[model samples]
Target: MWKRGVVIPGARMQRALEHPGTRRFSLTLLAGSDAAMRVQDEILLARLYNELVVAGRIHKTTRRNRFKGLDRIIVEVLGRELPDVPEIALHDVGASSGVTTLELWKTLLSVRPGRAHASDYYANMLLVRCEGHPLVVACDEEGAPLQFTLGEFVFSAGQRESLFRPCNRWLQARARARLPDVARVIAARKEGRTLPSGWSVEVVALWHPACRLAAAADARFTLGRHDVCAVMSPRWHFVRAMNVLNPGYFSPERQREAVRALAGSLLPGGLLLIGRTREEADSSNVATLFRASSAGLEAILDLRGGAENKELVLEAGKRS
Candidate 1:
């Protein structure tokens, strides 16, 4: 019997398992299997990620090897422009699960040594224990809470106080009834005691095969939270923002702000790669590469006809 809110290994899981290529990324599986345990962690992480996306309505999806063609171009550009720079610094924004980030990191390292930083607005999930009861909270890049979870019950930042909202009342009531300590957990959180007595909260990253592989001792790689819209000191030699600056995700004004902020975070003559991949069988990568300069971003290369919203980049450059 499946527990409430537990994702069952249905057709999708079976299909992935049958085909070895996607089994590790499957979100549904038998609860006791090793792959299932890993997938359970992923599901929890996804729930937390989804909470932030739903609240902010941001388009921050990612996948492994999504930048196969684009990464080759990036490496080629770096090798040509800064061939002698022994250590290049690269930042991957909105690096969901860090899969593609790691992929790009390894690809770049193969050609030249560099430090890779993977960042996302929603990066870590906190599992808090209060008197043996477990509660999970989704935290932003700053460690601020965005959503809370008790057992199968997940609620947004302020939804706890307004559990009677017409759309969520029934589900909220049922979860509350099953896990009465949810009230205690909330009360404790209000008092800043997320854990009782000697218990400590555990922080877990979104599980991915690539993330696990990167966990090994490597001074060249780091992971953290960052909101691209915020001002940041210029540091990186290369910055990649894939599937993040989409017109569907942000308003024209917000996209302009993000573009400027990203452009501002580049060293003189640094490169900014922004684009998205199609969902077709080929997963064609359509993006634009810009070189940052004193004046503004100068388009240097376009892959598969450039980014779908290259006008936004141009508009931002005009105003910058």
Candidate 2:
């Protein structure tokens, strides 16, 4: 579902739908490629690096390759479960536009059976006064809800702004990184060489913290370290595979204790599939969380493609 040039819903749209408090909204598909078209204010950059698939800039199968990695992690998780799971809830933290969600559903449903839910904080639901009172509406253009309002969930613009800030900031930073290159590409358009498209740019712009936090909240509340933290970058996307930098602990001091906690929570033969960066300094507080949840190391994959900046994949499992 998330091939390189395919236009999917942007993160903002995903937020509007996944947020529990939202109610009504409508959409009409645009012409041309999805990445080539979008609202002016909501421009999205795709994550892949391709001059053109048909023109032979690079292998057209890059998109499929990324999804293959995602499938590997999913299969690994299922393989380690005691007797095969009838349903599995995949938590894609920092899910932007639910692209990963669509891909996961397509893959897992074909083989294993289960539910896949992607999450992002609700952004479009707004609270306002009508005539002389307060009301809530599911809206997009800041004017009004098209035809409906639903439920009793109350929300304020301030809350929406707060929840949306982190992801917005992340995108803004990527846009900044991309602007100069885009300008040059566009300036050279006299020969018909132009930049990929708004959405195409975004796919590459996605980085670790920004993209992950965008979908982070989607996972259910209960997570145990040994539970096999399956993570994938999906091909053409910037991330390689998810990694747990220090396994269960990021620092020397907490390493052993964190490993213990992770081991205690995991069922026998449980696993962790992580996505991380090859960049030397890439680290985070998640070490505390993973350390408390994971068991001893099992297998690890260095999925980096010799790219200067890329994420890595790390796996840990509870011994039987």
Candidate 3:
């Protein structure tokens, strides 16, 4: 996850930096809904799970899974592709809050703890998340989220009418005011004091999750504030750019450059996986796998979400 203050070399777009002609290769963009968006509808919440907070007056927006297609063909592919090496290094691009990132690591480690033929290859993995601007965290003075309590309910005893006005009105009109209402928020702290009412929300300092995670100082995992456009690291075995690449966030040329940067960060014959997803439970996503070669990155597979897609959608690289 990318932090606000930490400086990561090459994380920014250095227009002065240029890719040599030899390194620049051609790539064909896959059409249709074949890859996923970085699918995390629920980001790091401002407050802890137990804290009482909501997304201001309006409800929060969640559109996709934190990680796309984790339980589907992806795992199968990983099991088959990942060598039984002693340690596997993965670069999870655009890892927000590290929920899906950490979960994926745990699943990978736990799935085959003692493979009969698998090597003891298990070690630290890298997660990179960064954007051009700063991340806004709604944490209180004491470090808890004040603006948006991540996991807390939105409704309170006082604001029940506003949040659930429709339902309440329906019940009154029908003369059968039944059916339990929305979950109410619990009392929470505000600026080091207990909030008397759940609706007493306020704007506290922005508390980005990257800051908290960075401070933890975990050795098993290292955080890098990296920009996908200019990743500054040695090549790796695998790189997953989940839900970050699209014409919407960046232009076509910049999109190509982003792919180039991610591909450059891979070792020869390394695997570069790109995906974007929407809708949490559907798990239906689009994924593209490319291989880094002397000729540049070549698409090897196009997964259109769900468990059905297993065959490789091989695409020939376009060379200028």
Q: What's every prediction's RMSD, in angstroms?
A: 6.6, 18.9, 19.7
Best by lDDT: 1
Question: Quick one: how many clashes does candidate 2 have?
Answer: 45
In model 1, what are the clashing residue pairs, if there are any?
none
Model 3 lDDT on a 0 to 1 scale = 0.38
**Residue ranges of candidate 3 with Cα displaced over 4 Å:** 1-65, 112-218, 280-283, 305-320
Better of 1 and 2 by lDDT: 1
In candidate 2, how many Å is residue 111 off?
0.4
Ranking by lDDT: 1, 3, 2
TM-score of each: 0.70, 0.31, 0.45
- Candidate 3 structure quality by residue, lDDT tens digits, 114-231: 1111011111111111133121223222332222111111112112223335653332233211111101111233234443442232222111233235325445455544566774
lDDT of 2 by residue, 209-275 (tens): 2223433554422211121223222211111113322332244333333333334333334443344
lDDT of 3 at 258: 66
Against the correct fold, how does model 1 do in TM-score?
Answer: 0.70
Candidate 1 per-residue C-alpha lDDT over 125-170 given as tens digits, one digit per residue, 9 for 90 to 100: 4444445554444443344445545554445543443433543445
lDDT of candidates 1 onward, in order: 0.65, 0.31, 0.38
lDDT of 1 at 253: 91
